[model samples]
Target: MTASHTPRAKSADTVSALERGLAVLRSFSEDRPQLGHAELVRLTGIPRPTVTRLVATLVGAGMLKPAPVADRFMLGPGVVSLARVFLGSLDVRGVARPYLQSLAEEVGVSTYLAVRDGMEMVIIEACRPRTSMLAARLDVGSRAPLPVSALGRAFLSAVDEPQRQQLIDSLRLQRGPEWDSVAPAMHRAIAEARDLGYCLSLGEFHREINSVSVALIGPSGEVMALNCGGAAFMFTEQRLREELAPRLRTIAQAIAHAIGGHLPALP
Candidate 1:
């Protein structure tokens, strides 16, 4: 199931112009870093004229700038500035980085710490084994799908029941016909997380990748997750379950203890 870049307004007080403008910005991604008004309109479902106006305003506000190519625009310094502020505010990243790096080096794999964003998990900290040539090609801003990714399922296991159900309902709506096929695996992942303090994604998110993840809760109850894995050939389901999952759980506990965070109780 594909997630929408544009968010739906949940209330009557929503400012549609602001929403549309944000949608225009959200249309830019790692794969599609630059877009023209026509592209924005197509991706965001906004009218062309509205997209044009939004682009003009965004460019004027320093949130976007013309790309090297004619009529195309890319996210600008303003977005970077905002991202810096957001990253700066995430204290957990600071606490988790060393542990993540240690795990990556020890396991000869990649490790990531992420938080939920709508129907996806956004990586805040990504670490790789410095001595190893093989690692997952993901960085701080990379996103993983909620239902299919171990990181995302671990996040689901961390949240309260109401929030989890709300997110699931939203996923159902977003996935449409695909929900039937996706639900069973997602439920299984959730169950694993609840039962074992971790979740596994064996070639579910990317057919070539396998990962295991554990959830963390901050002292004030903020939710986050950590995942470790690499190429499918190196991280088989048995290896993940027997070898990596225990270490991953230890790192989760260590991070939680360091940050005064909490790990979900296993049943």
Candidate 2:
């Protein structure tokens, strides 16, 4: 998923039914809780009969379940079950395992990979050293808000200024339960990160955890980040500045190389 992996040229081929079927499945969301055949036809602009057939097929396949209210369908346990398997197979951990281990070993802390997910970053992989003090046990699926975590700032640093500003504006509009006091400082942090090569969060996301991060852009220019984290007392400001930041830049460059693209100059 990095610059080293060139993307295949787009094909002019027609859309496949399977692709359309998946799109139909994706069209339903929390807002549009239940969908009927006619509603799906209106939403997808697919023919009514085809929508009906696909809905029936999906229902039979257990990807959709009949709603308690008559004549509606909702996403089923089958989708959740399949999605778990898919996420487990994503292999970000496999790709980042050695690098994260190396980073942890060098820094004597823990490292993690977090991918941007809408308004938050989801921790996809984590490598922790045996001796490091952990303020929190960040599991694979933990979600962290953008304004609080170094992983978010690393991603924000790589994005264009306009998008970064927009996300900051959005953050100003909403505040997390624990972060009302920290939001303004986080805004400054984001701007600072834009100026600096990377971002650092010092006990901002969690009370006793500190993290430093650098961004990685994939071959398609999609942004991801690598974050090294530990107890704030152990991962001191001096350590982040004098040690961890330099090593993170090296790991990110390696990831970009492995992923394939025109690599950006290291900051």
Candidate 3:
């Protein structure tokens, strides 16, 4: 898991200790699953003494366990239990799975349903063609950067201006000098989504991948993204725009309709 963007508490009633403890947990990721006290302190920018105490508390609470490597820790079963519960509670995932699965099998590509988590799109549901041996290996809980992935651009297209600007500003700050190089393509993707009702990322996020995605806005205005993608050679820009894009848009509309949200007009 990537670090979630948790906003700073402005109210006096918020618990700073709990916030710090959650930050400690968020420091762990798929690429860096195990961290020692010093690593956690550096990754989270918390004081060493505070990180030590927080790690001890988390270990005691079964949220962290000692790694086989000396003095390092891995996320524990408690985290899995919490994640299970959270995933189980998502009615939209249940509603979206069959449609996504059908899209995957029909197109011989992998499909995903993702929601924005801070500056990234986090996969809440994923499906791959049953007969396909070659597809993107993303699964539930996988994260994709918001500025490059089709899933992320679809999300950006669905959000209102103020929220989108806020996210763009944050990305500018986060990306620093690299924002100049990344911004133009991101802007084009957003425009494509708004105009065509879907966005395509052709060999953008990964050199060997191509994807098309559309936004699904829930009844309460919760925005999610749906994607259909596979190897770049298999899902070329022309094939995606001429073939897969319409199907992907239709699936998004079906999902929205099933979940009692306003159905998007098909192109």
Candidate 4:
């Protein structure tokens, strides 16, 4: 099922104003959390004059604030208010946080809980060990692309065949020529996930990272996924497949039970 907050447009005639506004908001990320007007123009490809007005409107709405370090802007309290409202409307996070946190600590890695949003997976919860030997740079609001992430492959495996094909078809259009080359590998990965109850990604997206993920039906009847991973050197492919995958699958089962979700049994 689709996420409630996922963007949608019924037709090509839909208003461009909201999309452009969101594009401006999305230009900020963990890597570039603050940006100046020029940087925003470069990032969003919205012309300088248009972006200037957009920035002004956002600032006026209290959605963007001036940065202390430089002549940049960071997302303001209004974004946090929006996030708070969205999170408060869901019980899954409250039910899953402690379990995910304990599991992350036990495994000494990063753990994530995410749901499909358009062609990507939006992280709803993420945890990292308090004293991790290796750092995995991910936060609750991070978005993982569908083509290359273990979270995405695991999610693809959990959905019905018809829906999966439909998504792939849409991806072909969205991702262009890259999807043609990536499809074979992704199909193999999804099938492997179906057999193993979890999917593995060894530097498929980020060369320095390796990950394992399992998708399950969420309490709200929407699909959600769990991911566990860290830096490549910290966990060998053999170790991830032989050891960590089982532990994650066990946690996936517990999460499934806790939230009235479906997690497949290992075959």
User: Following a full C-alpha superposition, what root-mean-square deviation does model 2 have from the true structure?
Assistant: 9.0
lDDT (C-alpha) at residue 7 in model 3: 35
Most TM-score-accurate candidate: 1
Once fitted onto the true fold, the runs of candidate 2 whose alpha carbons sit more than 4 angstroms away are 1-80, 84-92, 176-180, 261-267
Whose lDDT is greatest here?
A: 1
Q: lDDT per prediction?
A: 0.88, 0.74, 0.86, 0.81
- Model 1 residue runs over 4 Å out of place are 1-3, 131-134
| Cα lDDT tens digits for candidate 4, 155-215 | 9998888989988987777676677778887888899998988888888877788999988
Ranking by TM-score: 1, 3, 4, 2
Residue-level lDDT of model 2, residues 1-267, one tens digit each, is 111111222367745566557756765754577988877876666677887888888899999999998999999889889868967875555777899988777667778888886567878888887776574577676667787788887777678779887877656555535456867667666666666656789988788888888777777777788888788888888888778887887787787777673223434
lDDT of 4: 0.81
What is candidate 1's local distance difference test score?
Answer: 0.88
| Candidate 3 C-alpha lDDT tens digits along 1-267 | 122434344478878888888888877877789999988877767788998999999999999999999999999999999999989988999988998898888889999999997788999999999887557788999888899999999999888899999999888876778899889999999988988898988888877889999998999988999999898888889999999988988888888888887533434
Off by over 4 Å in 3: 1-13, 131-133, 263-267
Query: Which has the higher TM-score value, candidate number 2 or candidate number 3?
Result: 3
Evaluation by lDDT, superior candidate among 3 and 4: 3
